[model samples]
Target: MHDNLIVIDGLQYSNWNRAIFEQLKSGGVTMVHVTIVYHEQIRETLLRIGQWNRLFELHHDLIMPVKSTADIYLAKKLGKVGIMFGAQNCSAIEDDIAMIEIMRELNLMIMQLTYNNQSLLACGCYEAVDSGVTRFGRQVIKEMNRVGMIVDMSHSGERSTLDAIEISQRPIVISHANPSSFHAAKRNKSDEVLKALGESGGLLGFSLYPFHLKNGPDCTLDEFCDMVANTADLMGIDHIGIGTDLCQEQPISILQWMRNGRWSKEMDYGEGSKSDADWPKPLSWFKDSRDFPNITQGLQARGFHDEEVAKIMGLNWLNFLDQGLQAQKV
Candidate 1:
């Protein structure tokens, strides 16, 4: 059961409330990389970072900030969910490589090269063309590797991802991504890219967003399990893990921001029923964080052994982080 396992969620953008923390505890999550910034939210990103810091202090019993792999293990032993602060967009640093070290000191462990749009550092997957990582992006990668922060390529353009992998002194992570072979979406990685990542010692955390799945909103837990299974078959279980990408507690306003590439957009539920009233109906897949157990059950039902399930659940991620952190030291 997930109860005795080190459950680590690769990414979550929840509203960060006591209720969500309770769900994390109940779900037995040992660590979660909570994304702090996105593409359109370029403005006010620092304010949001402060908000998360305050939440970590206020919810110290339920969560603790993780600056390194050792902190993660310590938090798990102390019965707290390790909150690894991550940036979905490097826009928070604006044009300063020095800020990377400052943020690293603040316990930001993961930094996504790009969001859904192009930035000064790299082109996003949704960009009109895959321009790849820029000159500054290469320097940024080196700084991140030198400072012990993990480089994340989840929403980066394919060319940019490849560039980062080639330039990084440490292995990077596609912290939350699906295979383009299964669903040819911009958000998914191509088979060639996946193989290259595995060969480079990088890990791919399979995502669980309905839009990224081949079946779309009608996707069942079995479909999600199959996606991970197929990825494991290709990358080996050691290089695969879960990256649910659940944004359950976020408001519809945030969703619109994500879709339209703006930070503060109004909600739009075009002539349809809404689920939580706070979010649109299309977001019904994220009913609550408590649904995580269903994923574990689905994996078991699909015949994944306890050890394999444990690796997919969190150990794989932890191992990757350990390697990445050690690489930074070298």
Candidate 2:
């Protein structure tokens, strides 16, 4: 592991527990942005946050809440994992725009405009007709900028994601997704989106989820790193980081909650075929948090310098948070 690195995973929705926390420590991970809400409403979201509060109380020695860049440094100084919260969809806020700031006050640092379907704010990748950002989305983006919360476009459609990148004053991010050019996954972004993200000073965290990888469960470390290098050439090394999208220890049944939520009575396969209802087999080298070092090694072997490797592993995210998390001066 790169001991001096400030490793941060931009997104993960694992079935978190003490065991995973320990693995993060063993892997030298310092910060992680975790999903607090998918399609949950405000009350449900609050309950999830309450659950996390209990986790913090019970596992104080292992993890701490992070609402700012300073909190991340504090966690690193104490050798604890900083758990930052994010929402995979805008459902938590419902139809109320004011809830955006309220969610920020509650420590939600990142929020996606849509998940895999059309939302009040924007259109998701799975939608047949992507109308792009709605009027409410523009307002939400402005509010997010004012409050220093990141606008994430990870699961949004091409037009919607591009619209968000152009509309937001602050640089937005695709918190966890790959380039569609690599795998042609619906959730993966396009070259236009990637270029716009880089030109706009945004970031893209590569996903490790089988559905997003070019070769699914069989993707090699070399292939993954090569994709990283290729993406870096387009987006700049500073704008790329690891967001593994690790769903560790989660049961196969949870896929329904993630994809279908309450919106559909039937199971939503998302990008998966019928067999994808179950979690795909994890990459052999990165089956859990403890395997992060494999990526560091892979990056080095792919010809990235130590500093660049450090940036990809975590420092870039730290810099991004420093610029994106400060509440704008009134």
Candidate 3:
């Protein structure tokens, strides 16, 4: 892997610390969209932003906040990792359309309409029947488009994801998920959704979460690379990138929080497996952020040309965000 190549992780939710920042720097990761909230309400989401601000203050030399694509370049030039905030669910804005631009101003650049259940915006992948985009969801998407906050449907259902693509003038993203054909996990997308995404100029970031992989943690680099190749043929090279979904060094409580949130009285194993009570074993090939280069090398070995490998590694993400992150011209 070339050190000069720009690498951007489309999504990650690691336990933030100086060490993780150091790992990203060592991996030559130029930028990452870090998950700031899954179920946090407006106040709690603000607190999360405040917490990240503190992390920035403490590790200013190793990491910096990325408010734009320009910051990504600056981070790479300075050898620091750029951290951009994302919300894994719509809870951050919490029923208020106006909060979209406000959160964007606070640097929450990406947000999903749903996590794994119905939300005010859209139906989740786990739902029995998808309602598609709600009235509130339509308004929110428009506001998000105006303000440049990305609409993510990584955990949303098929109808809802397709609805979002059709409704939004700007291209949305699936920040982290795989194709259901590759693995039948509820979190993965179908070929129909992938094709629509490619047609609408949307991007899909491949997930590395164990459950989303074909064989979970034991999935080999070759297997993973093959999946990428297959997806590229389905969605085209420009619409795919790495969004490893790496949740490193988090405690069990956090997993419980992500899965259950506040709605469940009983434990809700998101994938309906009791074994999901604990984090699935991490992939052996990708133990941490420092292993990002392994993905680039795997793509190369899987017969991706240098340019295509660069696209899958990070260039696709950067180019997609270049337009999507900008406020719509009225």
Candidate 4:
């Protein structure tokens, strides 16, 4: 069933090409918050932003750039998927707070404090010592709030996430995260963090990565929906949404590079031992962006009403964006 819903994806890192765009269109995605940074590929990040801009210009009918909630509403009206640029790592800012506004003007709507390791702003979940949000991180959060970019805490450590939530004037988002209660992975957020997020009026996009699910690599769409529904039931449906961290079409070389932590500026590829085995095995169900429909259908089969399903799919994100954009105006 084609629902005329304001569907928004919290995070996607696929290899952006015509094929993926077509698939997104087929899936009825109204807007997508796509991460442009991971670890420290500054050059690659710039190139990807240009590519997305070109896509917006070339495929104007299929996609548009989203800088605010109003843009998303316009895209929905026009039946186009709005591309909301986000950075998964502060490394893109390269220790410069001024770049935050520059990137925001370029339509980078959301930014995670760190990727999966320590940075100038915050420590990631995988760090051996959780250092929390640094002084520079406080500056970053203030600038982000001032400039109207959504503060994302998906891969940030527990301490860092809490600090961000406390300091941010605008509501932060765990753009893509799973509950530690279900999966004890370092990448998953603790129940305490989830509660704080809800209390802070932020949103949590339940991730669909297999390792974060109860069934791990063997998880089905049903399992994914149950996890999200459970999170919604606990955190309040208004604060839950979809942030499928899908990397289906990414090059295997990129995956290998990320696994080695070569993408981080702090880690030396040769000196630091590889940790490819620790990386989660990609799920069989995550074939491409087109599989988004399966998630919607699965939620329907699980007995969610149309309004609840719509909220889980995208309305929740739309509402969160509206709050952030409104904060920007104030």
Candidate 5:
């Protein structure tokens, strides 16, 4: 059953290598959205893409760039993983709406408006007072819609996220985050936001990052599936999919780069955890891409029909991106 499924992890950042790509194949992963730049500017963003270009060149047999929905089908047919590039912050655009189209043409198809901090476009989840979308953000969203670039609010504030959904004509996405009701984490979405996301034709890719889960690294497959069930009831099953915010084999030093990102010299541990200095221990049942099948089995055990399980696993993402990746009709 799992073998025939079209598995897609909506987000993941890892120390890329032959081993991880092999793990993705072993797990039956057909495509994955990989983070390109967290806080990089235009030139740096290009450099990061160049780095991935090297990866695709070196690992040609195992992975291919996914510029459109068709690329995903091609990857599956060829038994290679389709890699979609996404910027974790709008910094690559740097207040210029034109960069959206340029980056999308470069195959950087998704860009989050913020990354846990207020940006030129919008306020991030960690902000005390949400400014919602700025004047530039409104245009950015419109231009993103005109082009094929996706507007991702995974790290955005409540007001900002809701503002984005209202402002954008295209169906945006929270590419990686869980429900606040599931864990009450600052990074998680409120029920109000989730409801609006579903109603607005957007999608929510559930995160597997331990900090976003109820029991942290000890969160069981059953507990996680229960959260999915609840979210499905709130936001239809077609609007939900997996985005294992999996950061495997990355060094602790990279944490400072992600959170601090040249803005501050301080160690930015936003939440609780004695292991805040390091990566939280991985969930025992899903330490790597190879364990993706566990989620399929867990959903089935929780009473989801095979078809429903298929959507949450990957088809939903495929269907969403099929239309989401196309340029708007003039």
Candidate 6:
């Protein structure tokens, strides 16, 4: 992997600290969209941002906030990792369309309408019936578009996902998920959705989450790379990138929070087996921020041209963010 290539992870939520920051630097990761909230409401979401502020101060040398494409370049120039905020669910905005602008001002650039369950905005993939985007979701999407906040549907149901792509004037995204043809996990998207996403000029960031991979933790680099290649043939090469969904160093209890939150008293296993409550093992080739070069090498071995590999590794995401984070012109 060339150190000059702008490597960006489209989505990640790690137990961040100096060690992870250093690993990201060593891996040549210029920018990352970090998940700021899943189920937290407005106040708790603000607290999460406050915690990130503290992290920025504490790790000033290794990481910095990314508010624009200019900041991505600045991170490269200064040899620091650029961090951008995102929410995996719309709970942070909590039924208010105005809050979309507020969150954007605070630099929450991407938000999913649902997170494995029905929400005020849309239906999640886990729902038996997908009611699609609600009237409120349409209003929120417009507000998000105007404010330059991205509508991400990685966890949304198919109808809702398609509806978002059609209704939003600007392109939306699926920041982290795999094709259902590769793996049938509820979190994985379908070919129909991928086709609609590409046709609408949106992007899909392939997930490295175990449940979404073809064979869970045992999936080979070849299998993963081949899947990317196949998906590119289905979608356009420009519409695909890496969103590893890396939940590094998080405890098993955190998984409970992600899957259940406050909605259920009973435990939810999510994609894991009912008895398995632990994080599935990551692929041997790409386990952490430091292992990113392995993916570049895998792409190269799979015969991707240097330019195509570069785009998949990061440049495409940079372009997407550049467009998605800027307020719409009148």
What lDDT does each candidate get?
A: 0.80, 0.92, 0.93, 0.80, 0.93, 0.93
- Worst 10 contiguous positions by lDDT, candidate 5: 269-278
Alpha-carbon deviation at 13 in model 3, angstroms? 0.4
Per-residue accuracy of model 4 over 1-330 as CA lDDT, tens digit each: 545767788988877777788888888898888877776545676787888778778888788888788898898888888888888887778868888888787777788898777878989877789878999999989989988888999888899999999999889999988898878877899988998898889999988776567777788777777777778777888899988887756665666565445644554332123554343566666656677777788889998898998988898899888878543555
At residue 89, candidate 6 shows an lDDT of 97
TM-score list, all predictions: 0.89, 0.98, 0.99, 0.90, 0.98, 0.99
Model 2 residue 71 lDDT score: 91
Query: Candidate 2's error at 240, in angstroms?
Result: 0.6
Better of 1 and 6 by lDDT: 6
lDDT by residue (tens digit), candidate 1, 230-256: 888887778888887878767766766
**Cα lDDT tens digits for candidate 2, 1-330:** 487789999998989899999999888899999998899999999999999999999999999999789998899899999999999999999999999899999999999999999999999999999999999999999999999999999999999999999999889999899998888889998999999999999999999998899889999999999999999999998899989999888886777788888989877788776765688899998999899989999999999999999999999999988999988788
Question: Clashing residue pairs in candidate 3, if any?
Answer: none
Candidate 3 structure quality by residue, lDDT tens digits, 65-105 = 99999998999899999999999999999988889989999
Lowest-sum lDDT 10-residue window in model 2: 268-277
- TM-score (C-alpha, index-matched) for candidate 4: 0.90
In model 4, which regions exceed 4 Å deviation?
40-44, 260-286, 326-330
Taking all chains together, the TM-score of candidate 3 against the true structure is: 0.99
Q: List residue ranges in candidate 2 displaced over 4 A.
A: none
lDDT of candidate 6? 0.93
Off by over 4 Å in 3: none
Ten contiguous residues minimizing lDDT sum, candidate 1: 268-277
Q: In model 4, what are the clashing residue pairs, if there are any?
A: none
| Candidate 4 lDDT for residue 117 | 77
